[model samples]
Target chain A: MKILVCVSKSPDTTSKIAFTDGNTKFDEAGVQWIINPYDEWYALVRAIELKEKDPATVIHLVTVGLPDCDPIIRKALALGGDEAIRVNTDSSDSYYIAAQIAEVAKKGAYDLIFTGKETIDYNGSSIGGMVAELVDAPYVSLATLFELNGTTASITREIEGGEEVCEVSLPVVVSCQKGISEQRIPNMRGIMAARTKPLQVVEPASIETLTSIVNYELPPAKAGVKLVSPDNVAELVRLLHEEAKAI
Target chain B: MSVLIFVDQTEGHIKKASFEALTYGAKVADQLGTTAEALVLGTVNDDLAALGKYGVKKVHQVANETLNHVDTQLYAKVIAEAVTASGANVVVFSHNQTGKAVSARVAARLKAGIVAGASSLPDTSNGFVVRKPVFSGKAYANVSINSPIKVISLNPNSYKTVAGEGTAEVVALNVAVDASKIKITAVNKVVGEVPLTEADIVVSGGRGLKGPENWGVLLDLAKELHAATACSRPVGDAHWRPHHEHVGQTGVQVAPNLYIALGISGAIQHLAGVNRSKVIVVINKDPEAPFFKAADYGIVGDLFEVVPKLTEEIRKMKASA
Candidate 1:
C-alpha cells in the first residue's frame, strides 16, 4: 500500500500572533515553527502506524511551501515517512496548494491520501476536499479512525453530536484530526536517518490563485478582568445579568 | 448575480447554523442588489416555504433520500450543477460539519475562490472582501476573492438569524447523481444533551478538578445554568470527561455567548478553541492562571465553595425572575 501524507509547517501554538507590513503580512520574526500538530500527531502518525502494521506499506510526505519548510518535512521523515516531496512555492491559497498536492498524488498513484483536518494558521478545513476534487477521488473529512482491509477502507468520523462509521474503496482522500492516533517522538536513530533520506523539490503546478489577504487585524485586547470576591457569588451573577448581559 | 445558500440538515431537520447562513446570504444579496435563494439537498421534514422568513426569496429542494447522509462527491456535484443552473455568482454555507466536508469541493468544481469560517458579510465598497478568523481566532484576516464566482462558509453563531414576514416559493430541482464511492454503516448519536456547537452558555472544567468523581459539582452548575459541559485537553486525556466534550485546538472549538471555566488554567491551545466566546468567566484558586487575562470576570477562590454558591445564586435568580 502506498500512502501520501500532506504536511505543513505552523507557528508553535504558544507564539504570539502579529502582522507586519501594514498588517498585510504575518510577522515571522521571533516565531517558532513546528510540524502542524494535526499533521504530525494525527495524519502522519496514523500513516506511520499503518506502515508498521505492514512493512510493505510505503508512506510519502508532501508539502507546499518554500525552502523554510524543509526542517518541518525532515521532522516528519524522522517519524517514519519513507520519502518526501516539496512543491516549491510560497502561495498560501488553499486552491493553489491543493492543486499542487493533487498533481503529486496523480503522479504517485497512491492508494490512500492523508491530510491534517486543517492548518492551525488558516483553520479553513478546505484543502483535503479540494485536493480530492482535483484528483477525482472520494473524500472524507474529520476522520477519527481509519483501518484498511485489502482494497477497502473503514473510517470513523465525528458528526455533530456523535460518530459516523463509513467505508470506501481504495484511492481515497481523508482529512484527520485527534482520536486518529497518538503523538510520536523521533528517536536518535530515526533522526540520524532522516538526514540521509531523499527530499525532492518539484515546481508548483500553474493554478490561478483564488484569495489574497488584504490586511490583518488582531483581536482587541480584553479590558482587565472584574475580580469579585468568591463570597459574593450573587454579585457575580448580577453583574453577568446586568453589566455583561451574557446570561 | 444571485446568491444561493446551502441549507444543511441531519435526520431531516434543518441545522441552526443554516438560518444564520440564510440571513447572511440575504444580506449579501441585498448588498449586491440581487435576490437570495436557498438549496436543500436531502428529504427534509421542515416547512421549506417558511425559510423565507430568514429572507430567502425561493427554496429549491432535491428531495433525494440518498442525500440525507452526506456524500461529499455527490453533494459537490449537485451543488455545482445547481449553481450553474441558477446562475448564482455567490454561494453561501454555514461553516459546520457539512460545509467543512463539501464546500471546497464545490468551489473546486466551479473554479471559484472559497473562504471558510467567514466571520461577517463582504465589504462591497471597493471589492468583495470578507473577514475571517485566522490563527484560531487570535487574529482576523480580510480576504479578497478575485474569482468571478465566489464561495463562502460562515462560521457557526457568527451571524445573527432574523425571521421576518414572508413565505418563499418552493421549487423542485432535478439533477442526476452518481453512486457514491463511500457508504455509511452506522451512526452513534449523542442523545438528550445540548450540542456543544449550538450552546449559548458553556461550563468547562480542567485538570484542577482532579478526578472524574468530582465532576458532579461542575455538572451541577452546568445543569443550573442550562449550559453545555466542556473540558480542557488534560481532563479529556485523563478520561475525566468524554473526548467529545474536550474543547481546545485539537478538540471541538466553541464560541458560546458565555463561557464559565471551573479550575482551568487556560493554555494557549485551549484558548484557541474558545477565545471567540462573547464573554468569559474564570474561577480558579491560582491567581496566576492564564485564563484570567482573557476572562471578563474572575474569581480567585476554591471552586469547591465557589461553584455551588454560584449555581445556587443563578437558580435563585432564575426563580425570582
Candidate 2:
C-alpha cells in the first residue's frame, strides 16, 4: 500500500502570537514552528502504524509551502515517512493548495491520501474534500478510528452525537484527527535514517485561487478575569445571573 | 439570484446552529439586495413555514427519506441542484459536523470559492471579504472571495440567532437524488445526553481533578446547571475520559454560551477551542494558571471543594426561583 500523508507547518502550541507588516503578515521573528499536531499526531502516525502492520506499505509526506518548510517535512520523515515531497508555492489559499495536491496525487496514484481534519493554523478543513473532488474519489473527514480490509478499508468518522462506521474502497482521501493513532517521537536511529530518505521538491501547477486575504487582525484581548474567592462561591453564582447573564 | 441557507435538521428538529445560519444568510441577502431562502434536504415534521421568523423568505424542502441521516455525497448532489434551481448566488452553512462535511463537496461540485469557519458577515463593499479565526483562534484572517458563486460555513456560536415577525412560503423542490457509494454499518452513540455541539452551557474538567473517578463531581455540577460535560485533551489522552468529550485544537472545538472550566490549565490549543464562548469561567487551585487570562471569571481554589459548593448554591437558587 502506498499512502500519501499531507503535512503543514504550524506555530508551536506555546508560541506567543504576533503579526508583522501592519498585521498583514504573521510575524515569524520569535516563533517556533513544528509539524501541525493534527498532521503529525493523527494522520501521519495512523498511516505509519498501518505501514508497520504490513511491511509492503510505504508512507510519503507531502506539503505545499515555501522551501523554509523543508525542515518540518524532514522531521516528518524522521518520524516514519519513507519519502517527502514539497509542492513549491505559497499556501495562502486553501482551494489552490488542494488543486496542487490533487495534481500530485493524480500523478503518483496513491492508494490512500491522509490529511489532518483541519490545520491547527487555518482551521479550514476543506482541502481533503476539495482534493477528493478534484481527483474524483471519495472523501472522509474527522476519522477517529481505522480498520483496513482487502482492497477496501473500514473507517469510522465522528458525527454530531456519535460515530458513523463506513467502508470505502482504495484510492480515497481521509482527514484524520486524534484517537486514530498514538503520536510517536523520532529516535536517534529514525532521525539518522531520515537523513538518507528521498526529499523531492516540485513546482505547483498554475492553479487559480478563489479567495485571498484582504486583511488580518487579532482577537480582542480578554479583559482580565473577574476573581471571586473560594469562600465567595455563592457570589460567583449571583454574578453569573445578575451581571454576566450567562445562566 | 437568491441567497440560499442550508437549514440543517435532525429527526425533524431544526438545529440551533442552522437558525444562526438562516439569520446570517438573511442579513447577507439583505446586504446584497436579494431574497433569503432555505434548503432542507430531507422530510421534516416541524412547521417549515415557522423558519421565516429568522428572515428567510422561503423554505425549499426535498422530501427524501435517504437524507434522514447525513450522506455527504448524496447531500452534495441535492444541494448543488437546489443552488442551480434557485439560482442562488451564495450558499451558507453552519460549519458544524454536517456542514463541514458537505460544504466543501458542494463547493467542489460547483467550482465555487469556499470559506469555512467564517466568524463575521462578509464585507461585500469590496467584492466579498470574510473574517475568520486562524491559528486555532489565536489570530484572524480576512479573505476575499471573487467567485460569482460562493460557499460559506459559519462557525457555531459566532452569529446571533434573532427572530423577525414574518412568514415563509414553503416550496417543494424536485431533484434527482443519487445512490450512495459507501455503506454505513452502524452508528455508535451515547443516548440521553446532550450533544456537545448544541449545548448552550458546558462544564469541563482537567487533570487537576486527578482521575476519572472524580468526574462525577463535575458531572453533578453539569447536571445541576443543565450543561454538557467536557474535558481537556490531556485527560482524554490519559483515557480518563472518552475522546468525544475532549475539546481543544485537535479535539472538538466548542463555543457555548457559558463555558465553566475546572482544573484545566489554559494551553493555547485548549484556549483555541473554547475562547469563542460568550462567557468563560475558570476554577483552579493555581491562581496564575494561563486559562485565567482568557477567562471572563476566575476562582482560585480546589475544584473538589468549590464545585460541590457551587453545585449546592445553584440547587438552592433554583429551588427558591
List ranges where model 2 is wrong by over 4 Å: none
TM-score of each: 0.99, 0.97
lDDT of 2 by residue, B7-124 (tens): 8988777888999999999999999999999999888988899999999999999988888777777788899899999999899999998898789888887878888999999998
Per-residue accuracy of model 1 over B155-269 as CA lDDT, tens digit each: 9888989999899999999998788888999999988777888788999999888899999999999888778999999998998899889999988999888999999999999
lDDT of each prediction vs. the true structure?
A: 0.93, 0.89
- For model 2, the docking class works out as medium
| Candidate 1 regions with alpha-carbon error over 4 angstroms | none
| Model 2 iRMSD vs. native | 1.2
In model 2 chain A, which range of ten residues has the least summed lDDT? A207-216
Show the colliding residue pairs in model 2: A121-B135
DockQ of each: 0.83, 0.76
Write down the worst ten-residue block by lDDT for model 2 chain B. Answer: B175-184
